[model samples]
Target: MKHTVQRDWRVTRPSRKSRFNFDQTTALGGLTVALFTYIIYHFIYPLISKGLLW
Candidate 1:
């Protein structure tokens, strides 16, 4: 028995540009930090302060 693959059935991938430049990356990083800080302040900080962080 012989197995063969077709050349026409190729997978194509998307190309990447300079979408993650310094400004964009920095903005995203800052946003992520702010979001994490907000979550900790609203969720974790209260629990810890109330001694319910067990």
Candidate 2:
């Protein structure tokens, strides 16, 4: 019987030139605003209306 050897997987790091243009602060700020707006309008508003009686 022939035995097969499994090779270890390795992650390749990207070059500096291929890095993101936007800084972490800007990226986080944009993402935070977008997520907040989406959750408030689509999720929170609907749930709030359900709990109110008029």
Index of the highest-lDDT prediction: 1
lDDT of 2 by residue, 1-54 (tens): 989886755547754674567789989999999999999989888888998533
Which whole-number lDDT from 0 to 100 does residue 14 have in model 2?
Answer: 59
How displaced is residue 26 in candidate 2, in Å?
1.2
Pairs clashing within candidate 2: none
Candidate 1: list runs displaced more than 4 Å. Answer: 1-22
lDDT agreement of model 1 with the native? 0.87
Reference-based lDDT, each prediction: 0.87, 0.82
Instruction: Name every residue pair that clashes in candidate 1.
Output: none
Q: Which candidate has the top score in TM-score?
A: 1
TM-score per prediction, in order, is 0.56, 0.44
On a 0 to 1 TM-score scale, where does candidate 2 land against the true structure?
A: 0.44
